[model samples]
Target: MIDLDKVAHDYGGGALLSDITLRLEPGSFHFLTGPSGAGKTTFLKLCYAELVPTAGTVRLFGRDLREMRRDDVANTRRRIGVVHQDCQFLDHLTIAENVALPLAVSDRDPGAQADNLSELLDWVGLSAQARARPPELSGGERQRAALARAVMMDPEIVLADEPTGNVDWEMSLRLLQLLVELNRMGKSIVIATHDLNLIRAAKAQIAARVLRIKDRHLQLAGADL
Candidate 1:
């Protein structure tokens, strides 16, 4: 569903990523692991078309990112869901409202989707907190809510950055199970996390390719994983 061909990215300084070629096939799962400042987040941005590569090309669904118009980019983004490291949410909105924002923005009728929304909240184990505001949620609740928001649009690919970063081990595993369930339903998944143990746990449930970015390059992870 996404392809990056020898893609390299740079800011005003030097390159953050180099020769990072990858293809995320349909219904596949991948874990992106690397040290801090190793460009794991940057790679996710490239995959989701948030940042254009300075050198090579990033193609989403066979279309080159650099060639897409502003509106085109926005439309393409509808097919990809991103759970950021910070998990930004509208504090003014309730957890259910925040999770349903994507459908609302897509011009979907909220009344028609109310039942699905409730089921989704229940799926993430946040049914009781649906009416609660984001600030009232625990760290794990926020993360699960974020995941709910990301996948509400039924996106073909889901990109999560440090999904287990803030939660305890138990919560992390719970979130991981939710993701694995999504993958089983045929959504391509790419999660950028430093927690190798989480990746190991996920492997027990589904087939996932472990990838690492080191020395400015993206490569298949070694057996250490």
Candidate 2:
């Protein structure tokens, strides 16, 4: 569902990524690991068409990103869900409103959304926090809220950047469990993180392939994961 072919990104004279190639299929979960400036985030952005590669190609859902018009990319994005490290949200909006924004933007039936919205909140253990504003939630609550928003569209692909970065071990495990459940339902999942402990934990829950960027190329991560 996601393919990156010989992709490279350059800013001015500096190279952020090079000779990277990857493919993520349906029902597969992947963990992407690398050092601080090793381009893990850049790679994830490439997968979702957030940033165009300075070179090579990114093919998502059979369409070449390079040839896709900007509006086309935006439309295609409806089928993809991304959870960021910062968990962007409107400070004034309630948690439920933020989570339902994706569906609203897609012009889905509001009445039809009622049930799914409730179920999603329950799934993330956020039903009680639905009417609360984004700023009122804790770090873990906000992270799960972000996850719920990402999947609100029932997207075919889910990309999370450092999903458990600001949370404790218990919350991290809770977040991982949510991702695992989504994968079981056939959503393609890619989590870009530098946390080896999280990767180790994930290995025990699902058959996820770990890929890393090193020496300017993408490679299968060591079994140490």
User: What TM-score, over all chains together, does every model reach?
Assistant: 0.97, 0.97
Local accuracy of candidate 1 as per-residue lDDT tens digits, 1-225? 899999999896999999989999999999999999999999999988889999998999999999999988888888998998778999999999999988888867878878889999999999999999999999999999999999988899999999889999999999999999999999999999999999999988888999999999998998888
| Cα RMSD to the true fold for all candidates | 0.9, 1.0
Worst 10 residues of 1 by lDDT: 104-113
The lDDT values for all models are: 0.93, 0.91
Query: What's the CA error at residue 216 for candidate 2, in Å?
Result: 2.8
The list of candidate 1 runs beyond 4 A from truth reads none
